[model samples]
Target: MTQPNDGPPQGGFGAPQDPPPGGFGAPTPPPADPLGKQPPAASPIPPPPGGYGSPPTPPPPGGYGAPQAAPPGQPPQNPAYGYPQAPPPGQPPTQPGYGFPQGQQPPTQPGYGFPQAPPPGGPGMAPQQGYGYPTAPMQPQYPGPQQGGGKKFTTQMQIIVAAAVAVVLIVGGGIFYASSGSDEKGKQGEASSAGTGGEAKGGEGAGLDGGTEKAPADTKSKVGFQLPHPKVTDTTTVHGSWVTDKAYVKTGVYEIVGYDLAKGTKLWSVPLTGQLCAASRHMSKDYKTAIAFQDGKPSAEDKYPSCTQIGALDLATGKLMWSKSVTSAASGDEPIRFGEVTLSGTTVAAGGTSGGAAFNLANGAELWKPKADANNCYDMGYGGGDALAVVRKCGTYDNRQLTIQALNPSTGAPLSSYDMPPGVEYASIVSTKPLVVAADVGDTAGDGSSISDFFSIDAATGKLIVRISADADKYAGDCGSTEVEQCGSLAVGNNKLYVPTEEHDGGGEFGDTNEIVAFDLTTGKLVGGRADAGDDYTLTPLRMDGSNVIAYKQPPYDKGGQVVSIDGSTFEETVLMVNPDDEAIRDAETSFSFDYAEFIYEKGRLFISEKMVSEPRDPSNSLDDKQYLVVSFTTV
Candidate 1:
């Protein structure tokens, strides 16, 4: 089973409660303020409605102490505290009123069947210990002294199964897919795995009852339901497993409970702490060390409101190795995310609210503080073993422009940085080896119909390598907007770039149609990709050990983005999340998992979130979503 993929969001859903008449796709804007600024030190601003970001004021003893029994006849609920739920995939509400697939559902009816916090068992609800996502825990045993390029790490290659493609005539036209078996029935069981009712103490097959029970000594405490979606509370590379349950280290107040990817067993829970704003964790190229981001309150200075730091965690014991704070005045609310942290040779770099910084990977010390004009920018793509590639936004209001930059990982040196050519924006750096590919994102039409425009970047010097476009803008379903050319998705592998295009339309107004165009990295020519597979195909290239494995979301269903992949000549898209039960899925023939966790593709396998569930008879029964599954992938 899986758990809700994201920790509860701050600010309580922060969107208009009502759905649009046009059917979904509501645009949620970036915060009025950018992220990552030094907090005001003099006097303090009154805390916001939600208890987030406010500097912690000492409460009288026992104020928010442990939970106690409610007085007699009390409802036993805390109305003052209601944590927010995670907005669905792509966190789309932020891009509201724009390019969206018809029939695609919006955030569930605000309080969708689960309580915000009172009944307990929320995804990040650890005991007193906390859990956070993206960054791995501060485990010890990480390496040391990363002042210069001391070493370079590389992984072995991996291989995966090949996918079988077939064509199906749907409403608009014919489409082809690699219908590998991704269990549709089990998807139902996925959502139903947690938070259906108030019954947290019940055993397996425990019907949704409001009664709360304690857990067995040998087993975990009685399981309480959490939000149906699996939250990515905290991720740390464990001993051979790479990623293990947060519970392995410290416990927290409330935690996300879900299945184990390797054994399919239920872990007690994953924790979420208020300290961490956002995070990212990954192993070194050589697999000898690990690096991560920690968006937390400053550990050194109380005068500093909150800070973002880089930390190294031991792969074996889950102990802290070292950590260094990233000081910047860009903004006060910078968001750190998955894939935001990268390790190059011996140096580590992380993107901030507007720019990126390089750090000593082993010691968490600052190697170089490189700056650029990226407004509210946070993720990055790397190329040329020694350089870091980034995109940043500059200026303010309407005059604002976003630009991409490349910096030498060592010596905190500048290599090349410039404004992305117009007509092309929000580009994603796809690869660095055979070639460096970057994607630009823009929106067209009244809504955001986006596309991915590919560019060849010089690997060593970070220059404009080349512009490779198969005229995707000419495609009929291109949505006619410049954004389509700017924001489409592209995957690079085997010296080829797989650029998915919006070919045909189906269902409501727009469709989830995805087409891939492969480009030869060396020749900059159109190399054949899944050209035969129509728009319905969704693909991502991954590296296992060393080989390339292409992962795809299975078809023959609606909505759920379940995955199946082909490693190479061998194929297998049929393998999907196993069913926990039918109640998890609501009425869809092909079972579906809740859209919560973020996806990270690496080493020939994919890692996705898993969740767990329940349904209650009592009106006020369910806990906010909990876990039933944890998203994890692999290749043969």
Candidate 2:
């Protein structure tokens, strides 16, 4: 998942793990603090009240933009910006915020559902035994010294799926999505159309519309503005962000706030009934997206409410557009809580452990509701945007069958379905148009990135094109284990898949670097073009800009980060926006984990934001570390 340092190995849904050493995007300590001095320690501040709508809570000492220090006698807790800080010796490891469980380490080889300790071998060593899955041996395109014996691994992950189902049944009949057919009757709500929610207040600025500001002839950028992190007592989640030509929109505690794109001044806010729980990564051409939130505010007894409300947000103009939810027959007609939401054309789709449902984007009308049947099949999740696709699970838990389907967005009908190979407990859709899917078949992707192979399929024919074996330890690409479309560090465009090689030794002393390589989707062969990240830097493909690949470069400890546009055919990079190397600005810029952070770059401006926030690691040694919600830079 593109960690910046050699931190703990990520396991399960808890804190993400670090990959093996010296590969693309490997974690290494940053250069010495640019401030050239330690921050003075301060007394801890009491946490704010519990529940939603609480005022912004400050973070622990030594936080970005604040005075930094560890308590006296406690070893310095300073860590590279954005990477999770490990607690001092003997103290419990730091816990990630937002409902992620603590203390579970990633399995040695890939295993779905439950996590077990790595089999006896040390890091980079292959697991001694397979967890009842078959193995397929293969070769790498650019072979190098890496973990495993160059043999691609897959596991019988269905066994763990069975375990999950049994646990759900035992735990008070929890939400277990098994659909044989469409049986649930959707409860129609009053039609709420786009822009129904009132417009947000605008700041004293002009050009409030879509499109980017003009770029400077010289691409070097300076600090545009920064938004302070909202003070949060608990580990709160601020999960969504978007940019319209006119404003920068972000999800706050119980509201969505829009700010002046270049000035960072508040322009508008759409307050919600509860905290935002899920957001779509893709935005429509009209700057519309989908989101999910709790129905009610959190109380003392029920601190975290179910994410049941689904809504479409208009980014150009601050509006809720429409908010609604559906009932699941499997859940006794209760509102089906969703874990993810996405937008495809005019369709808004939501899915979770209970099942999945779709709605009209213009008006919150039910398009379809999941149904129960003999086969016990359900739509696990979907990948949206250019096209609509779904990862459907069917059959018994012990012999669960996963299929990737290209669907008709308007009718929610499958246009084509490609059956996944066995032993894949979970699958993620990397792209819907090309219908590329990734899975840790046999749990062989030991790096915990949940990717071992990329299945390039013919969406129209529902036939396999090629299986690109991307050993997790060698490539930096990662896809969410459960979420259908959450993938990063790679991009698919121009009939090719572009992924970065693991970080390795660079030419200069004390320098490490990597490159982005392309693979032909049809033939599954290396395209022989590589875009190198110069010494002490790592390049990750962010997205496709026409035929060009826009990438972000995580710089060395002493340098500022950079955004570059690489020509697809030539593999040549053109500097788009280069952040300043000033000490203060550098710290602020680098304080984002490549994997977990949200990066938006357009028209010579780059914005970095966090998806999660929490209190200080050592609450007792709290300092007024100036934390920020977002840091922006521009070359205009």
Give Cα-based local distance difference scores for all models. Answer: 0.30, 0.61
TM-score of candidate 1 relative to the true fold = 0.45
Error of 1 at 606 (Å): 6.5
TM-scores, all candidates, are 0.45, 0.69
Off by over 4 Å in 2: 1-215, 616-625
Writing each residue's lDDT as its tens digit, candidate 2 over 94-144 gives 422111122454433222212234445668744332111111222211122
Which candidate number has the best lDDT? 2
206-226: candidate 1 lDDT, tens digit per residue: 122211221122321111122
Per-residue error at 369 for model 1, in Å?
Answer: 1.8
